[model samples]
Target: MKLGELLAIIRRDELDDESQPYLWSNAALIEYAEDAENEACRRASLLRDATTPAICRITLVAGTSEYDLDPRVIRLRRVRLTGNSTPLVPVTTAQLDEEHPGWEDETGEPSCYLTDWETGEIRVVPTPTAVGTLELQVVRLPLVALNDMEDTPEIHARFHRDLRHWIVKRAFSVLDSERQDKDRAKDAESRFALAFGDPLSARTEEWNARNLPSTHRDGSE
Candidate 1:
């Protein structure tokens, strides 16, 4: 169903008392907003305290049918600080060659090797010679409440539209950041080229021409 309808159902179920015109008074709304903001901060702080570093994953899940009910499906992901450094020990290229003998030479760089001592799984590790210490950040939606929004048709519709917009925008932001990061790791001059393939290359001419302008407009110049 549409998000608006879902939100409306939540509202109606939660707040069925028509007598109260302002189901959520202005003070209550303000308090709710504050509570949400505070909850986000509090959860973030708790993560910081629990985790060794100041980085932790945040997941948001919005209930569609019942707030008390388990989510129809749970989505999970992680988040980490931008500058947090992780360890990268060195391994011999010759050792990697001995392990993955079938791996053809794709990029002529010296292959790095890694061996899972326990599993005996040997694999060639991509070497970030220039870029030392990399960290993978995960972003996720944890929990969301659609309570009482579905009851009122107008409020439900608005909530759905707004919620979808919020989700899309947030998701896009995370993807955009990740793309930029991968481009940076590759030491590429342009994120657009890194993300959509080389624009100047003859093979990718069609895709380049189609997306280059939009990519530039998207601030990937």
Candidate 2:
């Protein structure tokens, strides 16, 4: 299947959990993942066009509370085109520390650090004891495609590492967007309350704005 088709399946399969609040209640998280996946597919297509290996990097900003809830959450995975099939690979802590040394703790787990990419840099630190956020980045490299196709453990291992980076980065984007949306909501609520002197009404309006249908409320004749 094409990359886009594969992504559709991945999103549907991996993100189909209805019990997760991030997946069910947060549209931003869902949309963020879709966009990240689409970007990865697009990059993959470009690599295919150039006949060169491509690397995609995705980074996520997750709250400390979220991370504490599930430290081992496998946030990202990817599938790449192989000889006759697509293989899925999970991103892991070991790979991240390899690409960016000293980024993880001595135990081979992720640790807060200052990450700099071509576009920008950010200082990542755990949030308060109960509340923290994670930052994720995905990088794509085009130079390794040919070697990745080789039938050897080394090739598979490298591909797996690359796939993990891409997937984690994509997952991070989902978390970051959700945090932004919450911040935006809070800001909007604050502004409305200041303007109207009625926090309850402002909250109600915000909820209505988010969920109400676009059509006229009266169902006009």
Per-prediction TM-score: 0.19, 0.18
Q: Per model, how many backbone clashes are there? A: 24, 27
Q: Which stretches of candidate 1 lie over 4 Å from their true place?
A: 1-3, 18-20, 25-128, 131-139, 142-221
Instruction: Name the lDDT of candidate 1.
Output: 0.28
151 Cα displacement, candidate 1 (Å): 16
Candidate 1 positional error at 76, Å: 9.6
Task: State in Å the error of residue 106, model 2.
Answer: 48
Give the range where candidate 2 is weakest over 10 consecutive residues by summed lDDT: 65-74
lDDT score at residue 181, model 2, on the 0-100 scale: 45
Estimate every model's Cα lDDT from 0 to 1. 0.28, 0.30
lDDT of 1 by residue, 43-109 (tens): 2211112132212322212221001212211111221223433222223346447765644433322
Best by TM-score: 1
